[model samples]
Target: STVLLTGANGFIAATILRKLLERGHTVVGTVRSESKATFLREQFKAAVDSDKLKFAVVDDITAPGAFDEVLRAYQFDAVLHTSSPFRYNITDIDEELLQPAIQGTTGILDSVNRVAPSVKRVVVTSSFASVVNRTKGTWPGKVYTEADWNPTTREEGLKDVGSGYYASKTLAEQAAWDFVKEKNPRFTLTTLCPPMVYGPPEQEVPSMVKLNVSNLDIYDIFNGASDPRYGVWVWIDVRDLAEAHVLAWCDAAIAANQRYIVSQGNFSPQMFVDYIWKHYPERAAAKGINKHSPGKYYSDEGIYGVDTSKSVKDLGMKYTPIEDMLRDTLKRFEDLEAEGK
Candidate 1:
């Protein structure tokens, strides 16, 4: 089957691109620039030459008919939409976050609806931010599941950094569901809501300073720049998350307008620090990694846990433990540092 992977160079989409290739699927990846398309071609040179991989350029996803030409060009079996604005620090919430997040999603869906007749499934990378209500803390023993939706409005997103991001994700995902409800396209939709995707990055990391948002805490902790402040303390490995996307794409039973909560379990920065101190003592000592007292860092109020039963049953999601996620993330940092990157 042929797959169209949007945002092919992103931290998570890169893994999805590779996984689809490994599964013997021909993939057409979309990037914002020629440079990113070149990077993908070089990264998967063998696949490209064998005619199993290709790329396209869609610079601005919010533009009308952004994906129309590409959708018309190929009979894609699945369209994995992973492109979204995810900056934490923002000046213009509407332009920077909401417009790209909301319009970008709708534009692609509209294209897929109108042009791509062969596309069977469309897997979107929604975030846990769209599911968890940060303001109204979760009750005890109340594990968040796919049924929950983040209650953030566009007005709330205009208030602050956190609300803006939450709102972007919420509105973007809501738009997707609404499109499916109204348009009733031939392709089924599946949304994966994973929190704080942390693990060894598949994409090139030029420097430790340029680590992705999810793995920044590991970098900060190793360099002694962080205390054990556990914020939104849950995660899923990038690799695992990518596989879940693939599962959602291939499995017709699981692809029917399902929203998956793709989390492994609870985690914290202190846990990473402890693992490094105990397992890689020499490096921990060299970096002067400090383990703050447990009382110092704690989970945010109202944030509790996530349930992955649906993912496990529907997508066959076998989670990678947080300890391994921490160790491997640090090892990637070490590998990059050794090469002086």
Candidate 2:
């Protein structure tokens, strides 16, 4: 099968690209620039040489007909759209975050429906931001599933940066479902909403400074931050999330038009800090790492729970343990530090 992977240079997309290739699928990845294309080519030189991997540039995904050219050129069997703005440090919430996210998503769907009729399955990387309603706070005793939706309005989303990001995801995902229902496109849509993806990146990390947003939290702890501010407790390993995307694409019959909340389970900052301190005592001592008291800040009852039963039963999803996730993640950071990156 030939797959078109959007935002191929991103943290999650990079791993998804690797998984697709391993499954004997030819991939055409889209990046924003030529440099990004070159970097991926270098990363997968063997695949490129064997004509198993290729790249295209789509500079502005928010622009009208952003994906029209690419969709017309390739006979794509499936599309894994993972490109969207995920940054928080910005001035204009609507321009920098909301519009791009909403438009980029709908733009691709329009293109696939209008031009790429060969596309049978389309998997989108929507975030858990679209699943959990922050206004509800902890929502004690409530278990969140694929059916839950973040009730963030466009007006409220414009109030703050965090809300803006959450709104972007929610609105974009909503737009996707709406498009399919109204347009009746040839392709079936599947959206994987995973919380706090963390794992060693499949692509090369230029430096610790350039680590993805989720991995940056771990780096802060390693860099000797006394407080590990735990936010959303649910998480999924990058590898597992990538596998979920591939499974969502391959098993078209079961995954058709489904929204899956992919998660390993719950975790806290204290859990991660304690694990590092216990396993790498020497490094912990050298870096002056402070381990928060066990169970001091986290409680299963205080936060909302996640139900991944749909993902497991439907996609045959299996998750990496928290300890293994931390080990490989920290090792990757250490390797980068050792190389002065």
Q: Compare the candidates by lDDT and give the number of the best one.
A: 2
Candidate 1 weakest ten by summed lDDT: 294-303
- Point out where model 2 deviates above 4 Å: 295-297
Instruction: Give the per-residue lDDT of model 1 (tens digit) for 170-275.
Output: 9999999999999999988999999989888777676777777767767788777776546576789999999998899786475589999999987766777778
Estimate candidate 1's alpha-carbon lDDT, on a 0 to 1 scale: 0.85
Error of 2 at 55 (Å): 0.6
Model 1, total clashes: 1
Q: What is the lDDT of residue 171 in candidate 1?
A: 95
Error of 1 at 238 (Å): 0.8
Candidate no. 2 TM-score:
0.97
Candidate 2, 2-72: lDDT as tens digits = 99999999999999989999898999999998888777899889999999998999999999899989888
The model with the greatest TM-score is 2
